[model samples]
Target: MRAVLLFAVFVALLAATAVFAYYGLAGPEEVALGVHGWTAMIIGVIFSILVGVGLMGLMFFSSRHGYDEPPQVRKDR
Candidate 1:
């Protein structure tokens, strides 16, 4: 099916990109970049916490401020 072929192509491209990036970054000594990995994890955690806090604040405000009430409809003659 077309879906299967598309999925295969996508996977192939993703693998190719991963291989290229690894080769480009790999030096003669083949050292692992620990700082980059840690930095990524730290930033990811911070961003996730910020998003969760924002969502929680929105929910709390909605409940406390009665945001769930329906709007009043107006009719004119």
Candidate 2:
């Protein structure tokens, strides 16, 4: 049930991102990028990669603290 809920949330987020990207909200708009399609694609790719790395780092840190067993639990039960 928890997995299902998580998957649903993930799907919802994906859908939202797709909608935003489709409408150009997720694309680059600054003049420094030349205001072209290729620039938009590059920006999107860069944004995705940065977000992916940040999320991975967060997962690593959270797992280290949240999923680690306590010292008491390391002993034979």
Question: For this target, which candidate reaches the highest lDDT against the unseen true structure?
Answer: 1
The 10 consecutive residues of candidate 2 with the worst lDDT sum are: 26-35
Q: How would you encode candidate 2's per-residue C-alpha lDDT over 1-77 as one tens digit per residue? A: 99999999999999998998776854565633445977889989999999999999988997888855455555675
How well is each residue in 1-77 modelled by candidate 1, as lDDT tens digits? 99999999999999999999888778455566588887998999999999999999999999899997899788874
lDDT score at residue 19, model 2, on the 0-100 scale:
92
Residue pairs in collision within model 1: none
Error of 2 at 26 (Å): 25
Per-model TM-score, in order, reads 0.48, 0.41
**What's model 1's TM-score?**
0.48
Q: CA lDDT, every prediction?
A: 0.90, 0.82
Give the Å error, residue 38, model 2: 0.5
Candidate 2: segments with Cα more than 4 A from true spot: 1-35, 67-77
**Number of the predicted model whose TM-score against the real structure is largest:** 1
